[model samples]
Target: MNRCSFCNRSADDVDTLVAGAGVYICNDCVALSADIIKSKPAGPKRTTPVWEGVDDDALLAHLPRIDAIRHQVDDDLRSWVGEARRRGMSWDRIGEALGMRRQSAWERFS
Candidate 1:
């Protein structure tokens, strides 16, 4: 059995379910970590790369496109989960990979 690096919970695997880097957390720890990361402010310096000489108007015009792409990505993730389920992957494993509860994964995908 694999043990969670953050909480010592027994698991079948130690792959990074969410949040890359060397953090190997259990399903429960993954959910808590996601919540904490989302709640925190963006911090003083923006981590995203900014294009040199890009005007404010040009950046503003891309917001809608960015939102559309985000929605598409969410849809793709749901479809991927469904496909994974068809291939015999368990909901618990899927939930852990998504940093969510099993019920949450089902509800979100369904």
Candidate 2:
């Protein structure tokens, strides 16, 4: 039986299960999500401004540090994906977990 993609509850556990976009959400989660959405503000959203203080030379000097961080992030992502696969999670579920498309996840990790 398939499990709720969000809560990992088995199909037998939830009162109802809804499936979409390669994922499932149980009834309880759905109701909670609806309530949360209802409680949100209706005002316009605000976005963070990009930093403009760093100059070209400063950016260039940080290239090595940026590259090291990128490598570390890649290693962590690979490790997480490996562990997820070992735990019997599907590519679709893994993609959902990582907030990416299933094909993107497979292309990056597989």
Candidate 3:
């Protein structure tokens, strides 16, 4: 049984759910959490002006760079996981390293 991230309720079929921050939230908790988080207002802060001068072409040109960066990050993460596994690291250890729970880590990679 997997424990719910929010309430720590034992649950089955947890592999089908999303885990966040050590919580294996059930579907109900997931919906409620989403609603609560969405309803919360952003704190007042210095508002930054939106840049209107940058055209679509410039943004489009950056897509490849962004994609490359994302790919590199993914590859790096995979490499790290491979190394960890090679060194006989436990799922709990990996999850702690990633700031998540062992179940969450397994859900993400397995």
Q: Each model's number of backbone clashes?
A: 0, 0, 2
TM-score of each: 0.49, 0.48, 0.48
Distance (Å) between predicted and true CA of 80, model 3?
0.6
lDDT of 2 by residue, 10-106 (tens): 7899999886544567999999899978987888874654336677887687676555544545665787898899999999999998899999999
lDDT of 1 at 39: 89
Per-residue CA lDDT of model 1 for 1-110, tens digit only, reads: 33455555445554443332323357788788899888888758556676555788988876765555455456557768888999999888999998999999888786
Give candidate 2's TM-score.
0.48
How high a TM-score does candidate 1 get?
0.49
